[model samples]
Target: MQKFILTAMLLTALMLAGCNDNGTGPKKENQPGEILWVEVPDSIQIPPPGKFHKALVKASVQDPDGLSDVDSVYFYSRKPDGSLANKGLPL
Candidate 1:
């Protein structure tokens, strides 16, 4: 039991020491009127199914430095209608 407890404590300490930074992750440089990433659900499940494309609009101007106004990350989804959807958390 003593050995088991020590092993567990050691494992926990190692895991905690290996902390992962969750700061915006990969850096994204702003661009003028540029669409960064676009994603689709393969197929919508509305009634039967439908084809839809979404643009992960980058709400910012050209700035290699970085962007601060991230209007949204997801643009376009079910129920939101033909309009573009935006679900970005601004920094």
Candidate 2:
């Protein structure tokens, strides 16, 4: 009897799971997830000790309605050491 009641409740929950009130996507609206394009400098006269200079870093390109749109662009470097103790090394 307990198993039957649990099964019925699960089925009811699954049936109601299709109801979405978020208008179909994220609050910002995007056909797909944003993309981040990163580019680093090739040659530098003076490179920072703990920094990898980045020439271009395109972030969060979105498609509002199946159309490509450039949302935000940023230029920065990623640390190879994976130690985020210091976040500012200049790019």
Output the number of the lDDT-best candidate.
2
- Per-candidate TM-score against the hidden true structure: 0.26, 0.26
Root-mean-square deviation per candidate: 14.4, 13.2
Model 1 error, position 25 (Å): 11
- Candidate 1 C-alpha lDDT tens digits along 12-40: 98887676644645766655344545444
List the candidate 1 regions with Cα displacement exceeding 4 Å: 21-33, 36-91
TM-score of 1: 0.26
Q: Residue 8 in candidate 2 has what lDDT?
A: 100
lDDT of each: 0.52, 0.56
Runs of candidate 2 with Cα error greater than 4 angstroms are 1-33, 36-54, 57-62, 66-76, 85-91
| RMSD from true fold, candidate 2 | 13.2
